[model samples]
Target: MATSSSQTLALQRNSSEQNRFMEKLMSKIFSFYDEQSLIDVTFKVSNPTALVPAHRLILAAASPYFENLFNGNQGTDPIIEINDIDSDIFERLITFCYTGQALITVDNVAAMLNAAIVLQMDDAKNRIVEYLMTRIDEYTLQSAYTLEHETKCEVLKQKIIEYETQNFIKISQSDEFLNFGAEKLQRILVSDNLNISREEDAFDAIQRWYNYDVPTRQQQLPLLIDCLRLTQFKVDFLMTHIQPLPGCELLAFKAVSWIREPTVRPMTNMRFTEPRGVSATNCGEKTILAVCSELNPKLQQYNKTEDKWQEYASINIDYGGYRTILKNDNLLFIGGWKSCATFNIVRSWNIRNKTWQNLPGMIQARRSHCVVELDDKIYAIGGRDGLSSVERYTTSDGWKLVNSLIDGRYDAGAVTLNGKIYIMGGYKIHNDKTNFYMDEHLQIKSVECYNPDSNTWTSCADMKLFHSSPGVAAHKGHIYVLGRGDEYSHVCVERYDPQQNTWSQICSLDVDPGYIACVLLDNKLWAIGGQSESAGKSCVSVFDEENFCWVERCLLPERKVCNCFVVPETLLFSM
Candidate 1:
């Protein structure tokens, strides 16, 4: 009996507390002038002002899609209906102009987009339509990439393509974007997922998708190039030939970025560059040297002479990580450990001096990251200080944050092609655990290609496999991926043809070097000092350029992580 009375008393107290809270709220709302008391509460009368046009008012007050239905009714028996979209959602959207707080969710985004389209708000329609395409498929998104990529309306498609491309967007049909030839969506997810740089190859993926079939056979580079120059522009037709490569998007991209842009100039210079169009095929090859860590800061080169790592001088750096190869002659290895994420220590190993020299600090420290030299400025992609945020490291501006990538990636791959950086898969933070090696990671296959020129990122082809901390090198427009990954410490090497966007398995290594750092020298790939393929032995291996083969060589006396760089006058040095 005492417990029952106590419960009843508690309920009465809670009711009193609720009434007090409501009274306070009501006091604030009713204190303004013209506010008055109703039966027992306060109320405010709303006044109307100007009258709206009858037709405009009717349209505004009526069901949004009634006009479309009315027009359809003119033809025959019309169907009339209303959707069960909640009143809360409708009110939220309707009040958006005044409150600017419509919470658009994936479930209702399509409905809202459809509403915007019905309202004939072209800007709103285009924005919502593009957003909607992301939720759908490539065929649907394809129309958005280049309206012409799908339509018989060539002129219109061309205009849209030109518009999007200028906006630095690689437009495509809705379905195509969703159904990428590469692992684009997956690549942009999380760490421990994948780390593919356009500089690496993904040939093994090509074989899996196409096989030895005629279409799969064409996915190979040598075949795709032939198709690009000779065949038609049908995605299905291109897939039908799925050579050893992946698809023809890269070819189309090259044509658009290099061939089309250079020759088809705007109004003024158009006629002048006309002659350069047909000869775009002969553009010379471009090679870049990738510098690994502070411990083994090494220079990667692709001269195609097949004489790489044949006793070249090794250059040493004073620091680790944050590597930038300048002017094709010197390597700038600045910031990393000793300083972690601070710009405290800085130096550039002059290939001429074979010794380290100093440069300005980049405002902060960056490690296990990327450096892209474009238009003479370096852009440092995302890494970690045990956090996930994207920042660009430059000497002038320091470490100013940029747009956060679609994913939190580290040990990722990045390469610059035609001035754009295609960042591939990498290991990312899977979860937050306090004890053990409790990090959980998701190996990704999605890719984000950043355009330094426009300071924007576009989604692109993804890697075939998921790997963490794989070495990447871009050679003559193809990518070579080395090092070990999650499945096996080091199992094999793969090649990715950007033109076709596919991967293929190369020769499997008798030994695998998980997280082994690699560099391209004279058309050959050289991997050095990595944890053994599950056995934990430390050694270096080389892949033959001419013949697809692997050769294991010198072993490190003590197991140590090392970075190598070409030293002027000395040969390559592994620190």
Candidate 2:
């Protein structure tokens, strides 16, 4: 171990002083540009007859290309011929080596970048990249992309790639997207980061690109189409949108068959790489459906595009504790019973096949249980059994018992957020030894969290008031509990911050909607389908983040009982 004295450790003027000294030295060296007394080299540019005088020592020191040129010269003329670059751009490159600043403009920035690459002046190239980034727009985006490839500017290329991905729908419609050569077009098309909500948009863009110059681009269709995830699209979307295009019959046939059986994968040559960045499949015009009510097997879906609720699907399932959830294109009905004996049946309606399939039933016949999907597995936790048991189910694996809850609860609210499942206030049987049956069934505010990674349960901050069948949802790492705090002021919206390990009521409902269905969609909170003063009317309210209040939105077409989970387009299904 060594220690320095206080006087020796004292810092002043620092690196700035050394930079100033170097600047003065460089300034003195540059002052001899016009003096031929010690001149050793002359640089010339073509197309405009521009000549600049320079010393070999300064030029060679600043550029490796120049250093090798001057050291391996075949003649003593002390002259260098720089061609294919504009004189103005070349002058800026040389000036940057001396002053550490390059004059950048819209007209000359691209050419300056090219010149900087030739001279290997990284500082000048970076400054030019910054300038181009600030000036990027719809008109200049194509040129920036072109310059990215020519200069091998990775920073600029990354920016351009991001810009294109975020604005894929916008850029696909532009003329520049159509004119990009096959190689460049292939690069953009293969990127899963393209911000398109629908696979049809990607298909449409490829068609337009092919149509732009049909005779010239027809041969490149196989290369271009191979980059699309054709199997991801619905059968109807394939037939309606992609099949009609010329030269699409073979691909369309494959897509249709793949939709029927996703197991039949595409040939290696035709298969596309999985999406590479943030998923683009989460947004679109989607419908929310309310399924089988207490008495009726009829199902209804909210058609957002048409602004109507239409009968979408039907299944003979009872209403009590029967929960419906939508994941990808499938809608699942988990638990709930026509009676105590019939409660364990589980079925799923596939949107692609328009068919229903029965899945492996849960170990316990429980209703009013909480179900949440995480990591492609469905978790059914807490129900009428008043047992702390929890079960997890996956496509490949059947129902497997996981850890039980610390509190034996039924009619509890559970949601998964940030890799943990949160079970909120629910009716639970007290653990009193003497009067257990008499003091059973309590709505407690106690909250518990289940971490799947550790297979353990931990306590969380409880809600302000006790609640039964409270609506709960998780978004952006926060859990929101609705209809839980105050009954008279039924708009009890409490937000739980996991980082702080605390819960606080942020907003309340204007109307007292008891036991409402809560969900977080598109980063907004929604409460739907609950009994209020005006019961029997479909009521919905959304959290207005801008004003910090709950504002009423569209109402359901009919008085639907049960719950609703939102998809891309808000869909409400009743039981």
Candidate 3:
């Protein structure tokens, strides 16, 4: 028995050493392939044909297509002719086979996936599909769905379906949703995982799709209507909206019958009748809260769907220069100046209850400071009196000091993006040399970023122009800073790319340059009311990302220096 155990241990040691040897050998082989050394197989790829070299052993091991090709051909160092696949994609796949790494991005993912499928590289195909799954946004969902149909990848199909289910409301509003085929549309409408507020929304989406091209899509309406939970709709809605539709008359009658009689199921193929799994908030309509004045203390809510504004709530205290951050359902009002004095007080208003509660104050009293929320913690950074101190707040632990800024600044535009806090362009107060009591304010164009993981603040690329209390927001993985142009006549909008650590100016705002409040709502950047050259301007404008211009939206109630943020429509109605 002891001899047998010793022999087994020796075999295990040999197996471990063999794995180490194979790993080292593969690494060396990849290095040789990188240098174009020891290349035994060459692929002549079509579509602007290019020759790509690779080792047969690596390709055969990674892909069954190459394995079968190499086994059938007896010749050594054979040049294989490949067609249809782009040369770039084929080269990337060949490199992936050798090095086990591929540069799969949105631009190349579709081509790489198709090439992987053609080459019978299941592993590479799965990786590419997973990459596509992670990036299934409105812009890419249509292409991904098309790829799923072209490649016949069941996993990709299910992933796209699940994304449609989870984001049904948002997806329904997208142009891609209108382009969905009848079969694909039915798959999403039948899903129980759909995050919709009511069954009527599902019907509405179907109606919109049918109306997009009524001549071609009229016949698809009946089949698509079977996917909705008809019993979930109100009797009036069924009669008024569904029954009157050209193709939905039969489904509407069955739905009305099922709603009236609780015991019997509709004698039709409409399987989905129960309510969809809705989230806490109805995502169809969004409510934006704009706090314009401290003295007037009015909280206004703007309904995007209605294109109207109404007074929602009010704050009793008269304060100004405070920053507002909405976390979950709580809107936090952080440090501000009142009666010519700065206070460290922090107050939170529960949008659900419509009540305000005082929380723990900061370590230092600050006004005109930038407050941002990241990783479920709120950070108060750089404020008045040349304050370089920074503090963080959590519900359980209260407020604690974090890393201080490299330079003290107030009225800076701060935003959180990709797990980092960015503070950009503000004013720094410096004492005058001749008059000791007099203070001089200088506009700062410098920028700094804070990383919580490292607990450090690093300098970023400086803005082209100075920004004092400018509007800032993060969108599409980039930080957008809207600075009121001091030198130029237009408002300068610059976008900062974190990966490149660079800032580039995009289209300028059409409104007169001033201290404007910027917020991102419904995937669009909005510049709200701010003091223009003469007075506070009530004009509002939204950035058209595709057109690279700012288009005018609805105006605010009054022309004032106001901060705006998005909230659920339910929050405003709850009051």
**Who wins the TM-score comparison?**
3
Clashing residue pairs in candidate 2 are 288-571, 289-573, 290-572, 290-573, 290-574, 293-575, 491-508, 491-509
The alpha-carbon RMSD values of the candidates against the true structure, listed in the order shown, are 23.4, 19.0, 20.7
Off by over 4 Å in 3: 1-284, 431-439, 487-489, 531-537
What's the true lDDT of residue 163 in model 3?
77
In order, the Cα lDDT scores of the candidates are 0.46, 0.69, 0.77
lDDT per residue (tens digit) for residues 427-475 in model 3: 8877567976665777888999898767899999898888888888998
- Mark the 10 consecutive residues where model 1 has the least summed lDDT: 268-277
Q: Write the per-residue lDDT of candidate 1 for residues 1-575, one digit (tens) a residue.
A: 74474554554557767578767754553342123222121111122221111122222333334334444543122222234434444333433422223456556655554455444333334444444444534334343444333322322332333343332213222223333442222122111112222201122233333333555344343332322222223334334443324455544444344333533322211101112112211123433233433455434432334433232344554555454444333455645654443453455554433555465665446576666654335666766542345556443245566665666676777766544577778767766677667657656777777654356676766666776566666676677766554456455566776444467656656664554556554456666656654353455667764444677754533343334433223222222
- For candidate 2, which ten residues in a row score worst on lDDT? 4-13
How well does candidate 1 score on lDDT at residue 29?
38
How much lDDT does candidate 3 score?
0.77
What number of backbone clashes does candidate 3 have, counting pairs of residues 3 or more apart or in separate chains? 0
Candidate 1 vs candidate 3: which has greater lDDT?
3
**Order of all candidates by TM-score, from best down to worst?**
3, 2, 1
lDDT per residue as tens, model 2, 1-575: 12333322222225466568777887787777635456776788876868867777776667766666776853256567878777877877877766778788888887887887777665566688888878887328878877877776655766676677788899888988888788666667666567788776877888888888998888777667766787777788778876766677777778678667655532211233234342223545444555435444556566655555666666555356677676554667788776445477787665434556677898977777888886557898878758789999854357999999999898788887655788988888766769645866778999998987678999987888776777777866688887746566565778887655678776577765654677665568777765455645556777775456687766654465466655544222211
